[model samples]
Target: MSAPVSTGVIPELFRGLFDDAAVFPPGNLPVAEAVPAHRVHRTAWYAEAVGPLLCGAGRLGELAAVPPTSGAVGGAQEAGATPLRVGLVLPGGSAELAPALAAAAPFELAGVELATRDAAEAVAELDRLLPPHVPAAVELPRELLRGDGLDAVLDVLVDSPYRAKFRTGGLVAEAFPDEDELAAFLTGCALRGLPYKCTAGLHNAVRHTDPETGFEHHGFLNVLLAARETDRAAAAAVLAERDGEVLAKAARSLTDRQVTVIRNSFTAFGTCSIAEPLGDLAALGLLSSPDPLPQEDR
Candidate 1:
């Protein structure tokens, strides 16, 4: 793999942790990487926070009702660009909102990711009533994104043959699938053709086992470079190997090629540690520049 330029990586890379999140450090990122994907999603409060920059109609029921003219997304479609995906964040137990949310139906925003089992069912049921008007996808809970996840949730709506048909998108939550468990998930995905974005605990650039905590940090940077054609069991070997020498070399160099491999995954870099975001961005050469405008301008 070759290193990618900051300009090339930023467009798709620029998405806030959640639309409602107000934690972005006032800094310049490539305009593209700083924005979310075609079908954007965010916590319910995202609109309350950065609603202006977001071109949605407003929160419709539980979903953000975005008119094509107002969103950052519609321009591409008009230009004959490949259709972009748009979706809403379905809260953990927003079942009651399903009917109303679906009312915005045949509407954009790739299906919804449910926060809980109950919410998953609601999205599934809504998909049923959607009448096939639009494409629908259901985000699997972190559990179903893991090894054996397909079977575990085979009976659940996340695996439903009907409305909740497991959409391809997945997320890795380090808590459930510790590094060891994560390896299984990655390997499984490789075998079954699954790729995902990880959230919350993966801000680091390497796969390291905290000496004190004895747990591994779930950064996909290492995985992107390390996963192989024989990845079905690669996770166990790579993670268990815990070769500080190899990962250390990669991080120290932070070469463009290495960063590009990781960025290619479109997987998120996250952590409870604030440095995680800056570190990943810095690794990608997404340098931080002071905001020219007053803090209020943001």
Candidate 2:
């Protein structure tokens, strides 16, 4: 029998979350509203954007949170809370990123993900530039790694002159490529024991089954699951071969619709709660709690 098909909730690689200054899902309840959740990770907005949700109402529970260094270091009470990670963004093609990170001290930088246009060159630069203490992710085209070319694509990104200086991480290229490349990248990452995370064009959670309608969902969940349990060959087969069962079996355990927990203002959940300093985002998502924000402020 053909491999089971995926539920389409997850992609075959990492989840590519888009940058948004604010989000409103057309609901009165604050159950699902995030502002600049993944994007605009500046610091000034944290106390207002994240203070309340994480420190005000209650703990958002255990969850994966990438607290932007710019947004978190303000010493908010919730700052001491448990966190999945504290991440920083490095601009693509930047040579100064490594030095800047090294200069900063006492910041428990869990990991860093940088955006780059050229995967091979970016990885090489990071290898030469990055300090061994830091774990970095080199962005490659998600579509390429998810297919047959995953191995070759990674081979180019890693295995460079400075390859040994840096550890293996996910590929984060912009826009998906053909199935061959995409499958190859994902499978290669898994084989190497690297965790791949994606960015951009994956704000939602469904594949564009109906491309004519111009509707598509994110594929983050799909990629992560398939990579974790399956081997490079198996994952490649599942993605390239279109044997849905192989992908589906893994997808079911990885994707979840639960509310994102709060870590900081620029965090996935903290931005949703409209805490002090960042309540302005509530306007974008249609909020209905506490007093109404001033019209001028909105």
Candidate 3:
């Protein structure tokens, strides 16, 4: 990604909004390569708008082997030392989670995102395995929504300390939820005051259909704006919108108060490539003059 030209500053609403998923699909960057890049993002001008580096709980051993380097920001202990804020992605079961969390106890535990069977069981497992202090999100597969279980799941999470998660896209066509489904989920979260995070398929700044795969992907901007709308239909419209300018206009029009409400509900989404969203935000006039990549990093 090219350097962001000096123009607009990132709105307070967007600060610390994106979590780096460089180790995941699409980008599939190896741990060695992803660590240095995440370090750069921590020190970048728009660092405030970035979140933790997401790693699979299974890869803790590989990541532990990498030594801390210079330029890591946030909560590092010393100059030139990397202070990592990490979120561990848990698999469908809890067998490996305990050891992984133990290994990562030395660093800042930003949160955990786990794949579970459904909402009720997820909440039960989270309570069983994770301490209340650690923020965790459970990803309920979209199929669960087909039955009345979705509402039950939402009610369970709304009453608990844990947050809800929705998968916006995947490697295959079935992974992306349709507009109505996404809008319903967002509406549910907004109404219940349940903050949520999204993962997968949000690769760019605006909504677009992939010509190669022909799958429609949701734009992070669309999701952000939609979360602000209380009207389910209106939020769904934003989710289905294909025009980037329209989405940008809506985003630019948000007030500080509105931004707060939206951020409180929408939270952050995981992306495999941080640079892609940063670049897109810059183009949309949302990110003002992002700090240039450090000379050494470049």
Candidate 4:
């Protein structure tokens, strides 16, 4: 199902910005439970702020086993309700995309994200197999980020229909790209006019170091602001900014056209916990609090 359009209080900069990643990483929510929780999110007052539920290609069988009635909420019947929208992640690369697409026929296939060492080969496969209407994001191998390989991939993507995907954080500290590297990526895509999405580790709206793991995390809001800067150094500066009020002030001051331009390139980021980012935005005054759910729904 297409995401419900945003209205009322949520700002234009944030609509459909947080793609649900509860099924992956630390959350690791089972597909059965995630389905019902996603239903609750879709039916909530803040539904517009949410995006498709992401599921790995290897886990489609687990998702397929979820009972039909598992998604029903608020007295709604499953028979006539919209199928859950899902973004398929192909970590095994394009080889797994075909069968994964077939398995995902049961849901609304929002998009595809595939990681590959060969950008050229992946683009060729995507061209041959991907439905024209379904968007795909090619994840360039991290090894390529610091070398000529990055440009080679960008060159291919510049001429293809697919966008780019970047990994911003992971389980270990080494997985998180430093401000300079991330700045280069933002600037690189901007130079080519290629839109991109981020996955993993963007747990909040501002940059900070995790006290438990000592990992320096990139903030989704910093990314939003960084995407708007043309200079690599300026972009890096934005990415490294840690003050919440400064980031919030910068975010609040964005003109409508500026927001459009920023979102056009930055797109969306997958977040494991929707409430964390939503709460951050609310605390920043960028988003108003959503109405409380009834006792039963709560």
How much lDDT does each candidate structure score? 0.38, 0.35, 0.78, 0.84
TM-score of each model, paired residue for residue? 0.46, 0.42, 0.89, 0.93
Tens-digit per-residue lDDT, 182-229, candidate 1: 555554444433334444434455556556656556444455444432
Query: Considering only N, C-alpha and C atoms within 3 Å, which residue pairs clash in candidate 3?
Result: 8-288, 16-48, 16-49
User: Judged by lDDT, which candidate is best?
Assistant: 4
Writing each residue's lDDT as its tens digit, candidate 3 over 50-74 gives: 7888988778777766666543433
Error of 3 at 221 (Å): 0.6
Lowest lDDT 10-residue stretch of candidate 4: 69-78
Report model 2's TM-score to 2 decimal places: 0.42
lDDT of 4 by residue, 86-133 (tens): 899999988998899888887778899999988889999999998899
TM-score of 1: 0.46
- Per-residue lDDT, model 2, residue 196, is 48
Q: Score residue 114 of candidate 2 by CA lDDT.
A: 58
Across residues 54-76, which tens digit of lDDT does each residue of candidate 2 receive?
A: 11111121111323243332222
